[model samples]
Target: MLKEFYPYEYARNVFAIDYKKLAQMGYTGLIFDVDNTLVHHGDDSTPKVDSFFAWLHKLGFKTILLSDNEKSRVERFNKNIRTQYICDAGKPDPKGFLKAVELLGEPKDKVVCIGDQIVTDIKGANNAGLASILVHFIRLPGEKHIGKRRYIEYFVMWTWKHRRKYRHRLGDILRSGK
Candidate 1:
């Protein structure tokens, strides 16, 4: 049961991810969480994000935004990045993740999901049989429900960091295909 929440890889944030190496690993698709993963809650895309998306494209990745946010929020954030997206996605349910995989036309094993929350993003990707990359939230959300989830995420991350198995797993992921 506890294993269901465990992410396949963990990183500080999206910028820290080694996309080039992932490409070499035969990963062809990337599904990203919009809110805290790409930017702070309710914020628009930054120059860094713009460049990163371009870089992903140049590297031949099929990228898509899979967010739980409403269409307005997702649309606003996507104005500059301009990737395909599914708004108001019911994550932690695998449906959204599966849809994302279908959108990329990539096999389950060739796709990766990147997000800041385990309860939703990580679990959803795992349920969809995709590799999940757990990134720390760029900034904590101000919403009551999301803020509450942040606390639980902190505890889970704390425990995850303390475990020897997780340490080895993290090391392996970082060194994979290098």
Candidate 2:
């Protein structure tokens, strides 16, 4: 069960990922979690985010925003980025991930889901048999309390980092052609 929370890859941030390498790996689609994963929770897209999406499109990758947040929240964040989105996605459930794959018109193996939360984003991708990249969540200002789940996530991430067997790097995968 704990293994389900393990992501296929981990990155410091979305901008830190090598999309070109992923495209070379035959990954044609990307499903993203908007809040924290892309920007701080409830924050609007920045020029950096806009440019990133444009660069992704140029690399021939189809993208989608999949979030558990309400439609309006997702819509507001996606307004300038302009990607297809599924709001109120009920993630950690395979349904939303599978739906994103269908919407991307790509095979499950050809799609990768990127997000900050392990339980929701990584587990959902694992459950749906798609690849996943886990990014560290962006911390919001004045955010002192993170709740119980975050503590558990921290422990999980600690284990994932310290245990060599559990660590998977995207660069390593790309180099091995796996």
Candidate 3:
């Protein structure tokens, strides 16, 4: 059902997330998708990304990079950030998400997964019983040729946006810092 694809929160970008609020909400562990969630596909970590991880560490949150890409790709992006990482994660399967929870040593109720895709990220989180935050995906050049999955995702997103109960008021969290 579409409920499985619903994210607990939605943010425009990783940088736009209100981590303080998430921490206050008792989310001590963060599982993040690399491509399109933290940076463009196949891109290295930006200085901003590095700083963000540093900030998260300072806030006492355990973080990990979870990617469907191969080990080399995940390693390259995580080189500077140095968070724990799991590659070839086989997402939307729940196994990887559960593995991340184990690796973080955090309770399921205290962890969250953040990613750009509903099919992989949100569904996997839901299946694993972890909270999820969805970020708009970064588009690649020649994106139209990528696949038809984006179209389906767009339809799902439209439906999600129209449902107020499923939407998280992230703006208020960002503004009030609560």
Candidate 4:
């Protein structure tokens, strides 16, 4: 059951994701988590992020931000990035993922969900029948409450890294869950 939280893949950060490869692999849409996935918690978009989104557009991938934050926060953060978004989205819920796919007007099999959290992002994408990519958070989290959740995620990630049949192909860096 814990395997349900495992991501289809992991990357060092959002910038590390290969958009070309994703497009080539037939993923036409991307659903992203805004917080730690795209930027530091509660921070606005960076120039790098802006460029990345532009690149995604150029590469023919429709993008959307699906965040658990309030509309104000999501709107404020998206001002510079300028992607379609749904705020206060309940993650780990199939509804949000389905809604994101609907917003993109794409089939579920052609969409990929990207985020930093396993409990929400990976689980939700898996449940919604979308491919999921887990990326390391841009910065250390400020909240103390997330530490325990992080610990739990580490255990599950460890299982995937050490025991899964595909672990050998993931290499040490990603398996380390740095």
Candidate 5:
């Protein structure tokens, strides 16, 4: 079950990855998960977002933002980023990932996802068959709301923080290219 989980999904603090390096990696597309991955959760917007989006735009690679949040929330970011945004994505579901892939206009083998959580962003990226890169959370936990998924959130954070213990398996999977 955990095999379907994504170890990446983070836009920050991920394994050594440079955006421009995608060309060398042969990746033509990039996928992002908003909320805690790109900006502080519940913040409704990002600081210096124009520059961040600008970097992606300058990369010449297509970018997409995938989120489980409602369309309105994703729309809030549409104006800032020069890419397609998919909301109500229900990560680990692969629907949004597929949509992003479809919108990317590139081969799936050349796309990667960046997000903060395992159950959602990371898991979804794995199921969607994209390279996963985990990043540290941009917001504090209090930013998350009180809900059932909150438990899952805690569990994922535990796994991420302890990833060093299980990292070898993750490395094998990523390297195997299966």
Candidate 6:
């Protein structure tokens, strides 16, 4: 499933993505997950995400935020980001991704869906016939309510370990201040 493919294996968080690099790879559109992706789950407000969105636009990669959370939550987060978004995305189902493609008028071959959770992001993207990425969630301190999800995520990552060979290789360049 998730472990057999390289595209599903080596994804870092949406923000850490190299849009220019992706453009080189012929990807022209991006779909992102919110919450711990663009901001801490508890924060509600997106921080520093504006700059990244701006950069994505300049690089010619249209972005869309997709989340299973309610419409209000997605709408609130999209306020300052200036990007299209879908709420109650029911991710892992391919509906949201399909909707996004329709909205962007872009083909699956030129689209890459980026998110943190494998069950949600990867599966949804794969089902939609789009390239997928599973990125580690942002680390925050003293957060609660993520209790069982951590275990579930661990299991996914455990399975995902099989594709480590194709995982994100830009780690060095990304951390080197690129």
Per-candidate TM-scores read 0.87, 0.91, 0.91, 0.88, 0.74, 0.82
RMSD in Å for model 4? 3.5
lDDT of 5 by residue, 1-178 (tens): 5556636433334333566656566778878888877776755655466577777677787888888888777787666665688888877898789889999898998888888777777777877777777666675656544557556766765675576653532233232111
Clashing pairs in 1: none
Best by lDDT: 3
Which of the two candidates, 2 or 4, achieves a greater TM-score against the reference? 2
lDDT of 6 by residue, 64-153 (tens): 888899888888778778798888888878888899887777787888777777677777887888877767776777655566766777
RMSD of 5: 5.6
RMSD of every prediction: 3.6, 3.4, 2.7, 3.5, 5.6, 3.1
How many backbone overlaps does candidate 2 show?
0
Global Cα lDDT for candidate 6: 0.71
* Global fold similarity of model 2 (TM-score): 0.91
Worst 10 residues of 6 by lDDT: 169-178
Per-structure clash totals for the candidates: 0, 0, 0, 0, 7, 0
Instruction: Let me know the TM-score candidate 4 reaches against the reference structure.
Output: 0.88
How many steric clashes does model 4 contain?
A: 0
**Can you write out model 4's per-residue Cα lDDT over 60-101, one digit (the tens) per residue?**
999999999999999998887788999888988989999999
Stretches of candidate 3 off by over 4 Å are: 140-146, 169-178
In candidate 5, the residue pairs with backbone N, CA or C atoms under 3 Å apart (3 or more residues apart, or in different chains) clash, namely 6-122, 6-123, 8-133, 8-134, 9-114, 9-115, 10-115
